[model samples]
Target: MKKLNFTSITKYTILFLIALLLTVTAIVFLEGRKSKNISLWITPASYFNEGWYYFDSDSRRQEIDSLPVRIPADKFGTARIYHKMVRSSHYCMYIDYYAHHQAVKAFFNDELIFEYAPPSNPGWLKSYRSFHNLIAIPLNRDGILCIETKASISSTAGEFGQIRIGSRDELLNRIVSERLPQFLLGAVLIVLGFILFIITAFYLRVAFDRTILYFTLLLIFLGVWQTEESRLLQFFIGFQALHWFFEYMMQPFILILSFLFIKELFINKKHPALIILFACITLSIFTQLILQITGIAQMTSTLFMINSMFIVVFAYILVLINLNFEFARKSVKVIFSISIALCIVSFIISSAVKHHKNFTDPILYLGIVFLFISISIFVIQKTQKQFNAVRSAEIYKKLAFLDISTGVSNQTAWYTLIENFSADGIKLDKYCMFMFDMNNLKTINDQYGHLEGDKAIRSFCECLKRAVGKSGDIYRIGGDEFICLCKNIDYTRATQIENMFDYYVKNQTESKVQFTAAHGYAFFSPSSKADFIQAQSMADKAMYENKILSKKGRS
Candidate 1:
């Protein structure tokens, strides 16, 4: 790895430059748009941000047409509409606007003109009117037109947004132009989420990355949240109040997944506080869910505050982890530092805004994008480490079973194989065990040093391997001692192979010193439960007896 300080500085510089470029570009984009006055017709909705008869709570609205504009888009509650008679000599007045998770009532000069169904009404939920619905409020009022609206969630700043009071055709055009940006970006995010989901599902191996999986889930929820909040889902699918479910549920989803992501990222750290915080968040979500489902409580006010606290708490944890250095790498520290700072700034800006109609702060979304990139880098690095560790373990395991001198199975492998066969509750059939002992290994070692003796042993083992080939398994038990377990081989073939081994020992010039091995074989017919070990013992005793016979013949 590069020096931590230099790598950290370099990464910070690049990230800062990228953020700067994006920020400047955003500023330029915002600067390009000229603010239009309320009286203009180019964008009529831009004129009606405030300045109308508005109330969040239940109260009788008075009919009166006020001035041009009053409230900003970020302030709470419905699109306030008052009487604005068209100067046309023939055309009747009609108002067009967008309604969010809210219902409205309009009064014409203190007379009940119309009462919009509340979002809680099943009829409202079943309406084909999307949140992007350009609701047309027809007015036959000569005196005044009064509108009052409220949202389901008390914590939500505004119930309805993008209010426009004008001719139907002009407001329709404005609707299209204003909603285009939200739809495009929402679609892009949804597609990006789907792609990430596929990558998390398919490319992972035996030992998978949980962090990436969780992060992918986070992306998916983020996309859903953005899409629903953008009112595009309504425009596309005609899902009216259903967006409220997504809007409410997404915070808990993000919170849970983020907790899991952080946990997976810091495997080495044991933070009891993190665990406790996760538990509290989980409990809060479940309790709120139960209450919302049972009609015991509304999810708007309390859960909103809880979600806000979760963000702050999670940010604080990230900062503390990064600062400790014991819990975080330099790259991770840099990422978290940027993340915490961004979170704070975004939170402040969002809170300071008077009318926050957007789904989320754009600054927070930017942080989310960078956090994802950093996490991906960490996952790739962590996965490589896991792969290397697995490879090392396999190499070590192979080394434990190998005989360095003979390149065959060592005694450890021999014992392990027996234990496995026994544990598996299986019996061997048509099996033969051959036991062999070198005739003069001690004499050869004494006369020609240990290296020559080792050479003789290797040559004998190599010659035996050639004769046996794939017909059996061989084990180097001890110095000058060996065993071969030949499966599926009849007695005759085992004898022939054994004789071939003896011939190679006597005539093969590969060994520096002439040598022979006294060998004996035991065969088992059909099958026997204890056959494997019994055959080995019998073969060993027969080999020693044969050794005595060979010494007598030599004498």
Candidate 2:
């Protein structure tokens, strides 16, 4: 792994801050400029089509999916409707409307203004209705609007949702402003989930427990579910059965997934409640699916909320039990607190929306945003700790093996390395060993101080490194003694390496004291009778002889 530098970190930090600033600035701007929603006119049931009719055939009006909001119906034929109202003098500069599943031909004040035909496939709808316009009637006094929509079983289930008008720029701005945080937050959570998933499955592999994996999957489900619940999803899903599934099914699914995630996170022993909770949720989900699919049950947001609350209640009780667990980490406590808080807040908001029709709150999205942000911080901290631990272990291993005085492998490391190779069944014949002895080291230490002697030793080690390069491993075997092991090298090259070190020392000018060493080398082949122990003794004897010869030359 590559090391992170200050430059790179600073660059990334600056970039992230800039992006965050821009996003916040834009959000503030959108929030500051309030876009007041003004309903133009309500669709009233009518029997007349105003002399305009196309695709009046029965085959084109097959039932597919029900709408979220109710509109006046005509079960036998298309529900022909018209509305007469005055546009407010304070009308904003923009207009937005959602005539769910309606094939519309609209007119304002007896003048044909707009036209749109529903597609065969329901997928033509997207998450946002930026361009899906039913009509472009100019806001004026005494405006008369007409819409001919196909009918369904329910009163207003066929033509669903409301037609809203607001400022053009402000409407688009509000659309993004309201939904942006949820979209971005959900996207980020999804990415984090994928990262954790990959880490568990690939990077960490076998080490990590399944708790993290379950958490990752829970996050993914939450993100997708949250996105689906947002107003933005209306444009993406159109008016298909998928909309109901997302609104109803994903809620219970996330709740159940969270149960599993929590169980794995802190509970080593699965409580009976865990199995019962899972079985009940599983049964509810499948039962709901069967009923809805078979048309026996009509799914509604109220019923969905009830199911979600049931799971949430059980989850809270489980969390309360685990929060008191003696072995739980502080992180686990924090997560528990956060989950409970979010659950309480969400339940209140959901209940308020269900009972009180006029109530609206954007603060609900903040819970999701905060939850993921908290999880992201935890992930970063945990991953960083793991990385630091591995790096520290490597550093300690290096420290244990290194000779502190000369930065060469110490005797202990030398034996370990040899043993590892020998244990692997590699014979000494595959290696060439050169032993070195520093001549007159005790005399130098007596003449000068130990510091200068140490300097001389380090200088000799440096010279040896320059001579050997990457050809072999060097070890400070003992006091004033060193050894080099070169694998697959012949005696000739070992002799050349020894001479290079000797030449480098003789030509040295930077050091205050001259450094000299005597070396003797021996090559071992597979057929050789001498073991490594015997070869080391032979090398030491030859090195002492060389030292004696050098002493005579000095005389």
Candidate 3:
């Protein structure tokens, strides 16, 4: 029942600031000790069978030597060595220096099955230094194979920091020191999301209407997806399979959150655009599921493109909704812009990694972090606004029902009251009705002013409202006339209400303009009573008689 203490932005900013501080402090203090850059000494044959591999990182020399292992020639159609190398330990700085960018050419009796970096022109790393490639090896009729790496680079050695390999035994050490920081940060973010979900669930009874349940579920899903352990599912099922599943699942959830978040933000739910967006998302999800089950990976690119388009469109709608509100508009713009930027970055990273097996760098995950943070903030801001709007609406509804001048039920609300108390019978239970008129109201308006007459009415209604208390209804149906109706009346309670009105008048003033109210009542058994109409007519006449008696006494 208290007013909102701060603006929407102030409240939401505090929330995100606290979360950010905790995350940053924990990461810096707990895991800040620097980790050595690990050399990835893995090879394709490493997965085929188990073997030992040597990883060497000298001043400018990066080498990976895997012991002899059986190459699977029956499957994968012409097996080859894929060279994927990335500099580790340095974040926020582009280190794309390839000291020696050549693959160790594999051969079967000198018959070349494939070549790794097909003879590039000089100065390829004029901008940066990194190398990733796949070198092929031929097989004899006896399933025998030979594999080796050949390297040629400038004599000028470059200062390099770290190296990682994906050969035989090193396969278990999938994530290295540099990668752990990012994965850990992701874990923290996911945990924060879960905490938020728990907080929301606590107030679930108050806030969980039909609409909010959808968003609550979404937050839970997001929390689970961003966890470090969730990513470990990749080890059980291959990375490619996990990648495909995630890409397909993200579209539908994004659409649901978009609609729910926007509705909460603006506090308006009548937008027609939401239906169309949902239809598109549902269709896309269904289409993607079918394509995935059909064992077709080539169509994934096209599916991704279409899905990305829908996401962009959904974010654009959010931008439009946010533009109307001054405080939220800027935040919305920031969120949408970041989303688009992240989508583009991820697309580029994925394509680069696909064409050249450079999966070591952390571009996609970085974008994901930014995207989650921005969207989470936006969702929280929206929820707060929705809460305030609903609260204000209830206040306004109560205000509308009562007469501000009389502090009693207005004529507009009296019928609704009758419907609530009415019984199912030809005639309702015994009741008493009191009608009141201020004596010489026209004279008072002529002598003093309408304002003075208005004060008398307000004062009388206050007395009436207080006296009615828990057992009766009072109405300001006319300018100077009022009605009090009591159901199943005991005259003792009735006399108290009437006496309280008289006491209020007697204590106020003894002037000529002293106001008094005429009272009347009618009681009957349901079988004998005619109806509300006939009963009210008798009460009206009785009240008139009392008014005449009061006038005579005053004279």
Every model's TM-score: 0.57, 0.58, 0.50
lDDT of residue 469 for candidate 1: 88
Q: Report the candidate with higher TM-score, 1 versus 3.
A: 1
Write model 1 residue lDDT over 150-254, tens digit each, in one string: 554443324344455566667656765656565555566667667755644555332556765776677677677766655556545644455666777787887
The candidate scoring highest on lDDT is 1
Runs in model 2 lying further than 4 Å from the true structure: 1-80, 84-95, 99-144, 148-160, 166-174, 187-221, 227-257, 267-269, 298-339, 355-363, 373-392, 409-460, 466-500, 503-555
lDDT for model 3: 0.52
Better of 1 and 2 by TM-score: 2
Candidate 1 Cα outliers beyond 4 Å, as residue runs: 1-99, 102-247, 260-283, 294-303, 316-320, 323-336, 339-361, 376-391, 420-439, 464-473, 484-510, 518-532, 539-555
Q: Whole-model Cα lDDT per candidate?
A: 0.65, 0.62, 0.52
lDDT of 2 by residue, 277-341 (tens): 66666776676656545555534422554446443644554464455333226775567557556
Provide the clash count, candidate 3. Answer: 25
Model 3, 42-72: lDDT tens per residue? 4322232222222233223223344222222
